[model samples]
Target chain A: MRNRTLTTITVVLAAGALALSACSSSKKNTNGGGLGGGSSANNGGTNQTYKIGFVGALSGPNAQLGINERNGATLAIDQANASGKYKFKIALNAQDSEGDPAKAPAAATALISDPTVVAVIGPAFSGESKAVNPSFCQASPPMPTVTASASNAELQNQGNKCWHRIIPNDNVEGSQGADWLARTGAKKVYVLSDLSAYGAGVAGTMAKELKAKGVSVVSSGVDGTTTKNYNPIAGTIAASGTDALFYGGYDAQSALLAKALVAAGYKGRTVTGNGGKSSVFTTGAGKAGNGWYFTCGCQDATIAPTAKEFTAAYTAKFNTPPSTYSPEAFDAANLLMDAISKASASGTATRTSVLDALNKEDFTGITTQIKFQANGEVQSSSLIVNLFQEKSGAIKGLGNIKELN
Target chain B: MSQSENWVQQLPQNIIIGLEQGSVYSLIALGYTLVYGVLQLINFAHSEVFMAGGFGSYLVVNGIVGHRHMTGVMVPLTVLCGVLSGALTGAAIAWLLEKVAYKTLRRSGAPKLAFLISAIGASLFLSNLAGKLFNRLPNNAFPTYFDINHQLFKIGNAKVTLIEVIIVGSAVVMMIFLDRLVNRTKLGRGIRAVAEDAPTAALMGIDIDKTISRTFVIGGALAGAAGFMFGTAFGVSNLMGFTPGVKAFAAAVLGGIGNIRGAMIGGLILGQAEVLIAALPFVGAQWNDVISFVVLVLILLVRPTGILGERLGRAA
Candidate 1:
């Protein structure tokens, strides 16, 4: 009786495992094939189709930012297709890196392998951007890449020719934030970084700028990606008795730190970089999230005059308002589409042609003037860093950081 | 004040924070130690069981509270509901895990390595399954039923929050209950017999399979409760179990792998060491993980087995 029962149970378990494995394998095949296989052979046909790849954290902690960017790009593509203006149909081939550098290479490889993919919108977070930029640069004919949200200053030093970011680098945002702090009468500032490429870069710049402005700076780093409890760090900050605390990290960690600081009874003003500008930060930190200042290269699309239509369309399509870099991503997609159109105006729009067009083209976007300098940075003349504050549970823009005084 | 003076002032609060964090680690560590006691197999899927408990409690709590602003007695009642639901869910998952991942292999008489690999596979399957079922957002927190950050009391400069008190109190109560259960109950004797000599215990008419299954259930219940506390303090996510789970596993090993009481001591020591060592101005917080492993290595070198020595049969 026992033997029969055991055999039946074993068979059932084995069948279940097999079924699950089959389901997962089939899902992968469908995702890859369904998205990338729609490439039309361009033999002088106006109905030809091309894919624009977006590689970012579609899941995980940074998913909100990536999802926002993907939605923005998707909206642009849908609008362009529906407008019947372009000769070719534009499709988005989005790959989820889950914000892990280890997972980025595979995601980037998947995009680069798809022949129809002319350009990529993002590798979203700075770590994933650093991980996948080499592949994007080293691709045959070199794939053009533009990031809407990655703000690491070190990314510019990577010397990748095809790399471009619409947003200002960490150097700009960090300095502006420091200047704002100085103007606000913060004498003793505590600067904490997550030790990630993005966090460290911004924190280092902010600390340097603060020191230059004669502000006493106490600096430290924690690997916020792995550390869950911030109370010990909060204790150190509270004990330091600083007037302002500046954190350079993503939303989740920053939110936790805010909660910890509040729990520790630290009354100091709290500030963070663009990485903490999402609704996740406010929601995660709860009431502690209120009255915190955020410095970002991206602006509020809902309030931008040029982005009114874009904002409305995004809200109507996604059933949620455009957030964070959604407008920047919209501009990036539109910029790429413009380049594709410009490149194809005279001849076929190959990867090389698209790159040439993107480099040479000067266009106006909803966020800023879309023009890349020799080193793939947007022209400094057009780049601006804005300050935002969380008040009464909503993140409100406080205008340009330079204009904050 | 000077930096040294600042450090001295911060020491009391840092210790309080460390103890609060350590208590949760101890609860999770008990799961690892208990499973190791009977099976001599490291169940990697236990982490997923922890994650499952968090989600399970989240569903029950979210269903009960919804968007309503909870206050007064509702807070404690809600927390109790969450803990019970979490424990029940964790026990169910762990039971299923043993049946699916361990039982089939055990019946086939597979090697120990196969069991380890299967546990890992099961862990991946369970976490990803959770991600697929729930939204994959990392910051999915419980509804604010009450002020989790409300100050319950204070130790020096450190304010002991309500959540911290609940976590530490529950963990202590559970650990004491677990210790007594293992030491005094008939099931305890059966478990000890199986751990000591499975074949001999089977010859003596104690059903080894039932004892092992029950042992897993007990461990799972503790982990599930820890999961609820952890989720309340931090947020719940599919990947939430990885860090705490690894830390708890380390605590289990540090306490002498199979020793239940040792796991408890090791967890407290590890937590205190991590927080206190990282609190030093020169060392900084980034070196916290390194300090934890270095302490582990140093302790292991001295004791060879662990702080308290290994084997549940000999110790518990």
Candidate 2:
């Protein structure tokens, strides 16, 4: 009787373990493999609820920025419904990417397999944007996506036509920054990169443009995203005594490097590309980041007359001030809605029609007048060069957004 | 501006940087070495042990120090509190890991591969735990107590920062203390005996499980201390452990797995090799990781037993 009971217990435990492993294995498959029940089967008729998918960071340090972007898209969807512009009621399936490339493909695939998602607003960051491109592009008719802010030049080079950006690519900002710095009479500049797909692309492009403009690049090194000790690199910078420094990375590391550079006796000017335009950048550097130049594709919304209405609407809706990239995200969301509207005016608005409309998209948004190039890059007025001053330590815009593609 | 043209100019600073980095690797490597020495199992979860130490330090410092400028009594006080918290955290977690993950398996005479997989699962669990608890930002700089970059002195053109001084000094002191503990003490004999022949050691009146547990404590303490140092210098993050942990493990294999001094030597060598390769003219820093691994592969190919040879692993 004891032996029979033991055998029964063993079988039960073995079955439980097998079931557990099977569940874990299935989770992995959904994340990595193709979505089994493809998107087309779920496409509802004109009266069904349509979702404009949004994917980006929503739960980390950059959470505020991503939330603002997501909120912007959400607001656009709400506004479109209120206007009664389309037969279908539009909503948002805003997935949290947490700004990780590893998490992006799954998010993108999930969005792709939702047939009611007529368009996607973003995979907001450049790195995540790149990772999710395959999902959008490889879809049968291709899902159209208009990004709020992913500006890595390589994204356009990927030949992913379905993915469009309202913000000028880093190629514009890097080239313009390099041009401005060269015009400032700096003989040499040290270029530093975080080596992310975004940072490297911008820094590399800037270096090429700097060399072309007769500015000598001293030594391009690293300000690694996770690296804390900047002294060694800073020492090299001080010893090299380059006339200026161009950092291509996010605000946090840029600030850290700026402080390190100051401590190492570097008195040269520092210029950060689009990625380093947050309050964290300045605060992290303390006094060191003051007077540093930061470039971006969007002007400060508070000062722009056209942006005033959007800013007020945003504040009223979200009950908070718009953060960095929020206005850009707002414009991007409107761009998507506009594309949908244009596609539907002539005939039934489908994924292919919406994508075709986005390809030739031209709209005067609050930030810039958008026109996409053949590479799916937005043609903005000009890239904004801002100074991280004591007053406007969070990247004060000097002029218009650049790179009309 | 012309620094890249002269390889000699870049070499000294790179070497100093390398040594500072190697010190952290050596501390973490010691954990892997000590555990591997006795159990004949590579404790992959040891990295998470180091990572836990960092988070532990961060919480301690944040609670005690708040955000204050570095100076006066606060500097040493914060350091002491943080390091202690880190060490305790590391020791406790590592002990629990051994108890929950490995102890039962060891008693059941599970295969070595099972231990490896278990260690990996434990590592993932701890990392995710930290992530969930502390939002998964890439970095969260501890409130500045002092400028870690204030130059202690210059070696050639290299500016040796205060942080490097702290890292190198603390690592050396800890490594020495551990070496003496392992070589000279009565407990050391028991540990060595158990490693040599556990059944024989048990017959000879040494408690096998106790000695193994104590070995973990020592290794974990070292890693915890290293984690604190790494946090102060690099800023604490959830993903911080994996890279350094892997590098330290590489240092372990490169030096001679299961050997104490071998890990130290391997770490410094690997660190210097990485820095030196990155200091090369043009395309330097871009391929540093690649070259570091290449050197390791080359060295292992030349000497399979590593520099000091496989001395600590039990020979069946």
For model 2 the local lDDT of residue A134 reads: 75
lDDT per residue for candidate 1 within B1-316, as digits (tens), equals 8887777878888888889889988988998988888988898989888999999999999999999988779888999999999999999999988988888778777768777867777777787777767866666778888788889877666678888889989999999999899889999988888888889999999998899899989989888888888888888888888888988899988999989999999999999999998988789898988887898899999997898888684444
The model with the greatest DockQ is 1
Q: Which consecutive 10 residues in model 1 chain A have the weakest lDDT in total?
A: A32-41
- lDDT (Cα, tens digit) per residue for candidate 1, span A240-325: 88999999999988988988888788899999999999989988888889999999999788787888999899899889999999
TM, every model: 0.94, 0.87
What would the per-residue lDDT of candidate 2 be over residues A187-208, giving only the tens digit for each residue?
A: 8888888888888888988899
Error in Å for residue B240 of model 2: 0.3
* CA error at residue A137 for candidate 2, angstroms: 3.5
Clashing residue pairs for model 1 = none
